[model samples]
Every structure is written in structure tokens, then in C-alpha cells.
Target: MAKRAFDQASQNQPTDEARDAYLEASRAGQSQPPETEAPAAPEVEGQETSEALQKQPTEAEDDQQKLQLEPEKDQTEQQQKLQEETDKEHPEAEGETAAPEEPETEPVDFSILKNGTVNKGGNVVNEDGKAVGRVTEGILKHLIGKKVDEKGNIWSTDGKIVGKAEPVSESERDELLKEPAPFESFPDAVVDKDGFVVSNGEQVGKVIQGDLAILRGKSVDPDGDILDKAGNVVGKAVRWEPEPEPEPEPEVPVDKSILAGKRVNKAGNVVDGSGVIFGRVVEGDVKRMVGRMCDKNGNILSESGDILGKAELVPEGEREGLKEGPFAELEGCTVAKDGTVVTPAGDIVGRVIKGDAKILFGRAVDEDGDILDKNGNVLGKAERWEPEAVERKKNPMSGRKVNREGNVVDEDGNIIGKLTSGDLQKCSGKEIDDDGDVVDYKGNVVGHCSLIEDIPKVEEESPEDKEKREQAEQDKKLAIQMSVCIEQCLDKIRPICKMITEKIDKAERTPEDERDEEALVREVKPLIEEGGRILSEAKGIIKGLDPDGRIAANAKHKSAAREATPEEHHLADVLKDLTGDVTQCIDNAKRKLEDMPHAKKELNPLWGLLNEPLFQILAAVGLLLAGVLNLVGRLLAGLGLGGLVDGLLGTLGISRVLEGLGLGSFTKSLKGGKKKGGGLLGGVLGG
Candidate 1:
């Protein structure tokens, strides 16, 4: 029963025989006691019997079972061992044990995927957020779902340590991921993190809109498609080529044949074959023409071309021969080249002998031996010439000579007037009739010319006579200069004298009852003072006349030695007279004023009439003194003692006073009369 039940249990288990043997052995061991007897079998069903068999076992039966199970047990042990080896070899097949629960692992931090995708289009970036290389499809497949270690190293799903995760800013990561993983390839160029295309560390261009690249100012697509700024395709990029250098131009030659047969004139003009001036030769050397006119061969030619002499050499005035034409007649006659004078009708009048045509007919002849008519036109050239004699007539009343040319001469051979028609015309514009009387003029006849012998011709003077003549002329000029000086001095004195006289006369004319003594003194005082100034000026003039004292001393010495010239003696006498006269006049005028009834006494207003006679005498004396000085000055100047004249007239301010007195013309004459050569007063007066 136990066997059947065991068989039944093994059949219900797996079909493994070794496992069934081991299970039967295990049942036998458990059913049998250590010393139990065998038991009977139950006549029940297979299931109830198997239950009973499992519930109780007999002692004898237990022993029998041990004996039987021994070999089976060995076999079961071997099979059981084999089966445990099989279960070890195939734990998943049936009753495999659950793998020992692995320790609960922490969730992987895939935060690196938040920064960028791990795909073929991604970049393998470095710590700086710069792509070191592209994320290839193989690299992406190896790296997907991978976690980064604390060191940023990424391990692949296949356990490979592939890439690293760099913790970059959000913006930087976004910027890096905007472009495709594998950037466009350009020769010697790459895109930097800043989207600039760099070559050999220099930024050559920029990447715009993530993929549009700009190079050399032109837009370029990732595929190297070149485009305009408006996004229109223009062309494709090509390899760079350098431009070729330009070639030089060839030089041209100059033509100088144009200058052939040409010559430059002195006027710098270039002349051609026909002697026509073309242009000027500003530079370079060339043959020059000689004269104004030239032949075709460039030879100098005369004006008429027949003459060899250059026309330029002829004098302009004589080129036309004689200005006067060949006349038909002259002086009532014409002359042939043979010196025969003929009438206008070709009749032979006379023959010129020895060129003295005047002898033939008393015709006029020029010094050139040319016969002339009365109007001085040349009739013909003569071989020789002589002047015609002039006829003279005598004036019986005046005994003066008159000539056909109207000159009238006195007996002394001095031309006094001209006789025109019947009247004698004087230089003064007065006429004298042939009756020896002044005609139609108001002048008395001071004298009449007497008949005298003809004057002899003047001979050449001797040296001594010349000296005397020159000395006389010098003395006359000196006399004139001195006279002018004295005249100017008197001119200055005259006005003061007149003013004094007039003032004194006015005082005298005043009625005694109406006379103001103070007024009379006031008016007369200035006049008296003025008279004193004139006296002082007169003294100064006398002193200036002999400023060096040489003239006075020389005159005195000459007079004592009796060696003085007549002029010198005269000068001394006139100077002495003038000095004495001026002194006496001044003294008398002073005495007259002093002798007044109240002259030296203090003014008594009551004695106005007494001063009247005194002023009148003073005025009369002043007027008389002026007249006396005038006479003396005129006499001294007339004597020709002008060398003693002083520049005191100008020095004492008398020239200015003369100008004011309307004697300006006289003063100007005196100044102008100063000789160019030094005179007595020249150095002193700035002549």
C-alpha cells in the first residue's frame, strides 16, 4: 500500500524518476519508526489508502521497507544529487528562487538632459558650454538614458564611461543647442561659442539666425550658398584668387620736321619760307634773321630791294629827301644845276659866280651857300655865299641912326628904339615922332641926341680891364642888395612911424575939455615904446653891418693910409652919415617927448592941453625922421656901398612886417635877389 501510495504521489509530481525515488525514500523514513513492527494493508480506495499509508506504518513493514529502500536510497541519492545539480543549472525552468532583493538604489539624476538632448544633433560640450565635438548617432545611442557622475563623467548604457556633463547656464546651453550638432565645415574656419566664424584664432565672419553665416559681407547658407542681403541666391562661394598687376604703356615719339626751314627773328618771332611770322620761339636755340625785311632765303633786304643797305639803318627824318617840293620860281628867278639864274619864262637872268649869288642880284644867301628869296625859301644851292649889306638912314632931329630892319641907335651905339614905318617906338611903349617930340604920351623931353661920330668896334678887353669890369658889376649887385636891405628896414620903420604920428596927431586934435589925460598917455605910451624899439633896431642893424668889426677897422685903416677904393670911401661916408642921422633922429624924438610941459612929471589929469603941443611935436619929429631915413637909405644904396648891407632886416623880423605892409612883392624880390654864390649876408640869412 505504501508503495502504491508513493507511486501515486510521484506520478502526481514531475516526471523526473530520480526525484521520485528521493521522494519515496523520504516517505519511507518518515513512516517507519526506529523499532516498529510491520502493520497490515487497508482495503480502501487509492486516495484513502495513500492517506492511510501516509498516516500509519507497521514495524515489520518498516523493516522490510528499509531493506528495500537501501538500494533505492543509493540510487535516489545519486539521482537526487544529479537533480540538485540540474536545478542549479536551470533555476528558472520550474522552481527558481527569487533573486536576492538588490539593495534599494537612489533615483538617477538625469538633469543633464534638461540642458540639452542626447541625440545625433546634440553637441558634446565642455565645461565652458563650448562644443568640443558633435554628438554622432553612435555616441548618442551609447549615451542615451545615461547618468552623470559627480565628476560630470557620463557612462554609456553599455557601461562605457563615454562623455561628461558640464553644468552650464540656461542661456548658454540654449545658445549652444540652437545650432545643429555638427557645425558647417569651412576651410580654415570654425564657429565659436559666440556664433562667430573664426579661422586660426581670428574671427573671419559671423553666424546669424543660428545657421546663416556671413563672410566678407555676404550672406552664406550652411551649404555654402551665397546670397544677397535680401535673401536672394546670388552665386556659390569659390576659392580666393589674387588680382593680376597692370602692364605699363609704351612711349610715343615726337615729330620735329615741322620746324624745318624756319628761323627766329630778334623779336622772338618764328619766320617761315615766305618770311611770314608764325609764332614765337620761347625756348631752345635757332638761327635768327637779321633785319625787318628778309628774302625767301632769309637774307636781309633793303626797303626798295634794289639797294643793299638795310632800310632800318636810314634816318627817319632824312628818308623822304627834301620836304619842300621842286619850286617853279624863287626870288623872281629860278636856277639850273649849272648855277645859272633864269626867269620864270626860261630867260637867262644871271650866272652865279663863286657862289656869291648876292653879287648877281643882291639876293639873300644862307650860310649853307643856298640862294633864298625874301621869304627865305631856297631857290638853289650855291658854290659859295656872301651876306648882303644892310642900308642905314640918319634921323636928322635926334642924330640917331635907323636901319632897314627897324633898329634905331643912339650916338653911343645903344639901341634906344625901333623905327616902325614913321614912328619911333620906345621900350616903355611910348611913341616919338620924327619931329623929335613925344607923341600921344604924357612925358617931357629930358634931352635930345646930338650928332656924333660913328662908334668904333669894341676890341677884346685886357685882363686888367676885365677885372675892373667884373668888379664894377659886383659892386652894382652889392649896391642893389644893400638897397633892398635898407628898403626893408625902412619899410618896417615907416609903419611904426606912421602909427606913432597918427596917435600923437589924434591926441593933439582932441579938445582940451574932452581930453582924457590917462587915455592920451595910454595911446602915446605904446607909440613912444614903439619908437624906442625902432631906435634899438636901428642900432642893431648898424652893429650887424660890421658884426666882425673887420669892415669898420679896415675902412678906418684904409682911410688913414689913403689906400681906399672910391667905392670903399663912399661906403664909409654913407655908413657914417646913416649912423649919425639915425642917432640924431632918435635923440631928437626923445628930447621932444621929454620937453613936454608935463613930460617927466606925474600925470595931472587937469593938464591935458599942456600934453597936446608935446604930442604934436613928437608926431612931427617922427614923420620928419621917416623922411630923413628914406632919403639917406636911397642915397647910400645909390652910391653902391651895398657890401655893408646886413641880414638884420630879416633877423629883426622886418621881412614879416614888410609882408604885412603890402610890400610883400618888394620883400620877395629882395629874397630872390640873393645870389646863388655866397654873398655878404648869404651865410647869415640862409640865402
Candidate 2:
């Protein structure tokens, strides 16, 4: 076998040499064609250096060595003795050679070997008296199988020897055993049932029956050689055994509740344990149901890292049967254990170990038990886990401050059913007033949720009970208000009735509603006008009613001088000045009467002609006239009257009287004046 292997290598020597030469040439920056040669005939074939080529001595030495194949006589004699010893062991063998026990003049060559030749077992001998070796698969394989003696020479199983091989220690032997065996060096025991090389109980790689081979590492080169762990030439390799893709990591089990109403954020992320978000959460979805949250820009705001983010909570059972690894899991809509997530009912439950974020679907909830959007809007109704009336101090962070079935308190300390947006949403069993509606910061009502209490035993007649209840409430309120007002007016006017009753000789009765409203006005008008005048006169007497008033009035005048926006105070000042002018004129008229006593005689007859008293009577008469004029003047002035008659009356005392009278009339007229004049006049005069 050794001789045959040598012959085959020698025949393919030219090709081998060419491959080697091309490799060498490439290293030298040269290009050369690959050579084809026969598969047998051994020779030392290679590119020789120019010096070695020019000498031609190596060839001459080869020829001389060929001629020297004949061994000495003594060596031939020793071979014959060995042949006899071999024949003695197998005496009945045909063509057995029992060589003559004498030296021949022509020395015999022993290096020649024939097919099936054998010396003892399968060891082959050449004609040059050399034991060549046994034949095997190839030189490399055979060399690997051969055992080396203490002298470092490799000996075949048949005792044929070859060149010395490198020595290895027992430690080296263990290391080689640990290292994956080369494809060609595989022992029969090394193969598995699949014909793959097994090492340490695992199939290291496979070997093909033909030229193709696959080694340990899953790498293939252009030359079809598979590399082993050490990156050495292991075999005439084919494509690497495709590593059976690791059985997809078994997926982790997820909870079923997580999937029931899994919520995610706008970016479709779930919430993490820290209440940080991992995905975008859109609006309207229950934020509490989302395990994770994200901003609109797809920025995950969780404790996890980039590229390999730890999924927040996902729906339970969503990661069913998934394994763990960076790339092992895809972004399936499944939740894993240890992931944080929210439930459909807005319960925020944390994930268990071995969980993922895929379990959640939309919107995210926070640890505060509030459902929030990516845009930070509170999601859905802010349902408290418990009632609002409980002691808040005990479980300050317990999302529900009250017991499960009690009232809830909002941030504003209002007892609400469920609070939202920093305000009270509902107060159980309480009626909604005008201020009960929920509104945005701009005071616009956004939406509403209703609260109703089932009144046991008191069945509602229909759904219209709300309207009935509301109307009944309003009517009760108005009735109470009307009773109080009527009682107050009666209390105030009772005394005045006695005074007016004795003055009348007879009285005509009229239905309360049919009585002339204008006559009622006329009867009260004089008093209102008189009261207004008195008030004006008192104001003038007081110098300044309040220090702030004078300062305020001055400020108004200054403002008018600056021509700022038209103000009520500015108009009031102009009226006040006219009143002052009117008051001065009235004082001057009084003084003129006192200065001219003779004029009273003329005035007295003039008064009689006029069907009124003069002097003291005229003063009283002037008082009434001033009251009427003051009212008319104030009315016209207030109506923005700016005419010569207004200016003249303002210069006279009548303008003050008019203002006093008209100020109250216009106010009373504006106020539907029925009770005010009657009550106020009686209060002042009676007091």
C-alpha cells in the first residue's frame, strides 16, 4: 500500500509540483498556469533555485544514487538470512525463497516493489533491498495513522519504516484529542451515525465519500477546503455542514390577561417597570392598558438600552414559546415575563422574568394608576382603584385614596366620583350645578361623564326623572327667594302705611295687578327724586365722602386730561362738576332773596297768582321743583345730553336737583323701581 501510494503521488507529481510552483510564484509576484500530470511515479519535483539548476549536480547525484542501488555483498547476505527466517515461519508457502547461504558477486537491488508484495505481513520491499511501506489512502492520511517509535521514525502496522516524524507528548496527545480531528485523520470510532465526525459527544462535522469534506467551523473557501477550529488545512473540503440553525430558542410563556386588552403607546411600545415608556402611544386608547409608553417621535423612554431594548410590559401569553437571545425574538405583538404592561381595564401589572414587550398593543399606563398618552394627556376616565372618602394619609400612593365603593376627592378638595384633568369629574349622588361641568383651561367644556345613584325603593318613573328633579329644585329655590323678598318689603313698608292712611279722607281700591304702574311710579317718583337730591346735597356737604374717592376723582380728571380711553369715572366727574355749579346757583338764589326783602311782596302775589305760596313756601316749592329738575337733568346727562339747556340748568341749581332726582330714577327705572323707592324713602324718613 505504501508503494502504491508513492507511485500515485509520483504520477501526479507534475500537477503537485505545478500547484506548489504557482503558489511559490504568486508569493514572488509571478503568474503561472497550473500543471497537469499523471497520478503515479514518485520524484522530488519542485522549482529549484537558479544555482541549483545550473549545477545539475542534484540530478547527477540522483543518477549516481540510482546506480548505487546495489547493496554490498554482506548486506545481501544478511537479507538472504532474513528471507530464510521468514520462510521458516511459513514453510508451506508457494514460491518460497530459501536463498543460498552465500554472497553473490552481483549485489542485489532491494528497493523495487510490486503490487501485493509482502515481506512479513503487508510490508512491501523494493528491488534496492529497502522496505518501502504499506499502501493507504494517501501520504498525509497514512502518516497520521502511523505510530512513531522512540527513534522518531514512523512505522507502518506491518513494521515497514518511513522518515522520522515529529515527536508529541502525552499532553500533546490530549490536546490533539480535544482539538477537532482533521477530516482525513478521523478514526473509525470518531464518526457518528450520520457519518459525521463526533467529538465530545457532539458531531464535530461530516466527511463525504468523494472529494468533498466538511470540518468543524462553518466556513468554506474558494478552494473548497473547510477550515477547522485551528484554521488549518484539514481536508479536501466541500461546503461546511450547514449548522442546523439552532432550534429557535423556545419562546417564554406569557400571561393570557396581558393579551386580553394589551395596550401600547403611539410608537407601539409598552411600559416598563419604571413606568418609563418604550413606544409611541396614540390618543384615545386606554393608557393604563398599555404596558409601555413612547413619545410621538418614536423615542423609547425606558430603562432599557438601545439596539437591544428590554421590552416594557407586554400582554401575558404573547411571548408564548419564544426563547431568549438578542436576535432570537422578533417584534411580535407578544408580552414576555418581566415586562411591564397595562391591562384592558387600565390595571398596570409588571412583567415576570423571561418576558417580552410584544404582548402589548396600544396606549400606556403609569405607576400612579393613571392612563396617559404619548402627548401626556390623561387617558380615558381616571378611575380610582378605590373610593375617594378613605383616609388618604395611610396609603398616600395607593392610587385610590378612598374605599372601593366610596366617594373620591379631587386635587381641588372637591368630593368627586372620578377625578380627571386636575378637576372633579363626578360626585356620586350629587346634583350637577352650572359649575359641575368639566372644562379645559380655556373654560370650554370638552366632554362629560355622568354619575347616578340608584335610590332603593324609590323607583324612577322614567328616564325623565332628571328633568323633573332639576325643575322641582329650581322652582323650590325661586319660591323661597320670592317669600323672603315679600316678607322684607312688608316689614319695611308696614309703618309707612299708617302715616299715609290718616292723611286720606277716602281711599279707592284697585286690584293689585290692575293698579296704574305709572301712578305708582308718580307717587314714588317724588320721594325717589327727593332722596336723590338729599343724597347729592349731603355729598356736597360732606366735602369728600372718602379720601380714596377724591384721589380716584382726581385720577380720573388726570386720565381725561391725558385723553385715555373713555371711563365711567370721567363721565361721573363731569356730572359731579355740573352738580357743584347747580348747587352754587341755588345758594346764590337763596342769598338774593335774603338780600331783597321787598321782592317777597311781589314774589308772594306771584306765588298766589301761580297758585302756590311764596318765600318759605317757595323755598319748599323750590325744593320739590329742584328734585324734579335734578332727576330730569341727570337722566339727560346720563343719556349723554350735551346741549345749551343742559349747560343752563347745570349753571342753575336745578341741574343738581335734576341729577339727584334723575340719578336714582334712571337707576330705579333700570332696576324696575317699584319697591326701592317705597322701601328707601320709608327707611330714610322713618329712621
Identify the leading candidate in terms of lDDT.
1
Per-residue lDDT tens digits for candidate 2, residues 306-345, read 2212233433454332334321222221222324443554
Report, for every candidate in turn, its global Cα lDDT versus the true structure: 0.41, 0.33
The residue-by-residue lDDT of candidate 1 on 1-687, one tens digit each, is 333434332211212443355443343222212221122122222122111112333454432221011122333344444545545556674332334332343333434434343333334444555533222112333444454544445556666655534343344445555654221555545445555555566655555443333334444455545556788765444322234586766655433334344545665454555745544443333233333333333334344554222112123343333344222233455445545655556555455655444433545434344677677766656432223556645444344444444455657766665443343333123334455443344555422232223334469999979975775555444334344444454555556555545654565566656655566567655655555555445444434544574443433222122233444334434433443333333333344444344432432231222222222221222121212222334444554423333332333343553444233544554455444412313322222
What are the runs in model 1 whose C-alpha is more than 4 Å off? 1-360, 363-485, 557-596, 599-687
In model 1, what are the clashing residue pairs, if there are any?
36-59, 37-58, 37-59, 37-60, 38-58, 38-59, 38-60, 38-61, 39-58, 355-384
In candidate 2, where is summed lDDT lowest over 10 consecutive residues?
609-618
